[model samples]
Target chain A: MEFSSKVLEKAVNEISQLPGIGKRTALRLVLHLLKQPKEQTVFLSQALLTMREEIKFCLNCHNLSDVTICEICSNKNRDHKIICVVEDVRDVMAIENTGQYRGVYHVLGGKISPIDGVGPNQLNINSLVKKVKSGAVSEVIFALSSTMEGDTTNFYIYKQIQESSIITSTIARGIAVGDELEYADEVTLGRSILQRIPFENAFKNY
Target chain B: MEFSSKVLEKAVNEISQLPGIGKRTALRLVLHLLKQPKEQTVFLSQALLTMREEIKFCLNCHNLSDVTICEICSNKNRDHKIICVVEDVRDVMAIENTGQYRGVYHVLGGKISPIDGVGPNQLNINSLVKKVKSGAVSEVIFALSSTMEGDTTNFYIYKQIQESSIITSTIARGIAVGDELEYADEVTLGRSILQRIPFENAFKNY
Candidate 1:
């Protein structure tokens, strides 16, 4: 009987190890690579090797970096006084894409998921508390996902810094920016109701 | 503004260079790696590194292997008389997955695409012809894709080996095995009509 090339199989195995890729997708990718220019295939393989061997974590915030402190932490112009805590580095990219934030970031590595046996101890929470206690930071923003594990992690961090004087905040929960009120999901409507604040309380300059 | 970690960014860049991966998908994969256990992450990185550094092409058939020859080429029990010529290592795989053919394979490295400036000289056709000329081969199967380039390649090889005594054949093309007649696309239906064989003689034994 016929059998696939062991090298192609090995390449497929390595590609399939990525987050969303499966065996079939990996095979397709291998086929595509075969059809691509030889230089492109060689470059991609070399890039994977270099990334695995060269890149490392930032010692300060536990984010990925080539240096001890990440670029964000080392930049003097960035606002070190404000820090945004997130579940992963991808969250940092998401917020950055919005062009609204101007603060350094601390990646918790992941959220607390008891079912997966991940807890506060598994994350870099101590480093965050230490950063807050340093007195250099004035505000800490929790910018985690809205999932159950994310909420549990947010609450844990909140309790950890409850006695500290640094102002702590979570991302607002309400109708999403572009979403129509009439088309709002039940969960979003419910959360908006519970977190509702009084309107028209302050005097307006007429 | 908040930013992704440098190591994560580097990893995403590397992953996105693979066939079919985009920037957003690469980010998702990087985040997934961060969520995995340290050992798992380490294993995946090491696997990628090893795949690039350890895998080598078979000296004989150009298949991937850890040593001088691939498993298929090294196997003594398989048919050494019949060689199936294909465009790449992946075609060897597609044929292998069917578990039908007992012949060995010769990967041409690529097909003949004049617009892309690919010719027989750029392929492994020289090695294939040499292998056939050695007089150990009886039948040579051109199991290439049914495309313009593939047809041009087959014709080129046929002309080059016109004097050789080996019998040559191609994979049959007709209504695909599992395709419904009503839903069959026009191109496939036309090809089936053009290549129609005598069913009366084919069913004589039955």
Candidate 2:
């Protein structure tokens, strides 16, 4: 991993600091950049710098945005009352891509992971609790993942707004649409059986 | 793959332009950067910009370097008369790491690949041939990869230097060290048997 040029070494060191890239991979990527037109590197550097310097988080949902409020939050057609709680902007994007939900989102930024030193205060929990207490929202749906952190965060938020009359619910956990039941984990299969719905409700689209 | 922020989208797009990186991975890396302190992003951008703007290639060997003549080329201790021809700077680094070859290197930058629109004229072959004809180099070792393009490039260079008294040789190809004989490929195994050295030369270290 010895580099003849200090500049190339510095670039490789910086790039390898990324999550999955290693020193050899960084060298390959840096050499690739060197092979391409200078304008490509210019565009990449400028875009990264501009994004880091100018990007903002939505004040309402805490999702990444270019303005104070994100496009989803500002949209009038989408239902703003029914808020879907999730981990981060990635989860928000995933839900948005499905085109199923009409309610807006409340990005918590991350889950409650004590191992990682992330607590409830570090997340956007207080703002969500305040929003629910304000009585402006009709429903709050927990759409976090099925991990322990997700359940803990869900329970913590549910406790904060349980006394209120607002109906709080969680996204259903079941076998994936096309997955075989035999391959499903025992916990998921058991939950699917316990939470079975009416036949007509199961295939409403059909 | 939908992005809410234009700046974020631009950065992801530029990053995905790199080799082996897709839009999803680019988004993940970009988001990881955003989660870290802004100074990390600044350092990465600055390093990349400086490397791309100021990096140089050795005028004598065509290897990536910070000066006109590389350290290996200028060192009087190394055997300048025995030149190891390689595909690029990576091979030079690999050979340097071995600490076995005291000969200087001549990086061709790339092999002759007609499929990729690369030819002899596009490489640093002319300079190497001129150097050989100057009667300074006594030996030229072909250490390019054992591919069709590599063979073609080696043969092309050999034809130019065959008229001179320079000794020309290619790197030995065989089963790698610590490799099982049963798992060795047929071609390499056959070559190893056919080119078996004398008993005294088989294990010089032993």
Candidate 3:
């Protein structure tokens, strides 16, 4: 028996590919889309298409941007000397919304997960190291998550920057373990940034 | 300070307009779109656009379809003499998935909600009356939800169809209060369809 239409089947399959959407949820979304005004659906499609066609990785910070340099990197008022390293663009937006930090950001694209076959070479770590080695940078703040992999990347970057005579710091542990930086509220993120500690004795036990 | 790019701002606003999606969720969805491959985003966008441009209300049943007459309406094997009236297209799909009912369907667009200003005339009730008066229909089934408004609309349609000689019936009351027909599992829905009671004196008190 033909259970569903071809287009609907394809659409449902695609929706099911999303993080938490299951087959039933995918069906609900497709049915909802079918009922929506044609213009609304068109807008959704156009936004997604433009998101791919127009947006690109910022050459300087690796944040999503329409231009080579993201708005944060190009802004003159932002403190270029202080760079906050984060795992993704969502983390950068979370930090930006705090309004406490005037520093720019560098998105590592992803954390080093050996289980997932991700390594330092796969991330934008080389560009970050080059940026720090230029000697123009004053302080490098680690805004990566407090996960095990996050700590490993943080220590790796800390060791890389310490050899270049640049000051290195990591956001305070006030952020509870296993919590994502992207989901952290603005006030908590701001407090965490304000309570940053020097990384000279970082990983002293390890 | 500009929080996001102009296009991104517009896109985020558009995404936030969707039901259950807030500003932060909209931002997350946008970031997820950015992470997806260009082709994936483009395909989703095109699908949305195509859904709007290609799909239309089936003239016979008011269900969404790519053609004037829907697949069910055009099917030669479906029982034309037995018509099931429902609130929306999703209900039609649910009933169809059961593979038990071979009857055609008539979508009422919405239930009678005095609070929401939806009246009997606002729905496709007049056309339903016209279809019944044409004399080919033997039985008319009310598969609307058990909500207050659904009950009101079902009674209203019943009143309109009582003048005709055609038989009328309603799906069983085993479906719980405030439950949507679309979300009901196939087995329960199939049981309800099989145990449908005749419209005359089905409600004891009313």
Best by TM-score: 2
For model 2, how does the per-residue alpha-carbon lDDT over A31-127 read when each residue is reduced to its tens digit?
8998899999999999999999999999999999999999999999999999999998889989999888888999998999999999999999999
Alpha-carbon shift of residue B183 in model 2 (angstroms): 1.6
DockQ for candidate 1, C-alpha atoms: 0.25
User: What local lDDT score does residue A89 receive in model 1, on the 0 to 100 scale?
Assistant: 67
Candidate 3, residue B71: Cα displacement in angstroms equals 2.2
lDDT of 1 by residue, B1-206 (tens): 23344445555676677767888787777566555555555555555445555666788888766777888888997897999988776677788887778889888877899998998898888888888888989999988888999999999998887689989998877787777999988887998899888988544441
Better of 1 and 2 by DockQ: 2
- Model 2 / residue B181 / CA error / Å: 1.6
Top lDDT prediction, candidate number: 2
- How large an RMSD does model 3 have? 7.8
lDDT of 3 by residue, B47-114 (tens): 65665566677788887776788888899988889999999866887888766798999999889999
TM-score of each: 0.72, 0.95, 0.79
- Of the two candidates 1 and 3, the one with more favorable DockQ, higher being better, is 3
Candidate 1 TM-score on chain B: 0.85
> Candidate 3, clashing residue pairs?
A45-B45
Better of 1 and 3 by TM-score: 3
Off by over 4 Å in 1: A1-12, A24-60, A67-71, A74-81, A97-99, A126-138, A159-168, A172-206, B1-11, B27-60, B66-77, B130-137, B162-166, B193-206
Pairs that collide, model 1: A64-B7, A65-B7
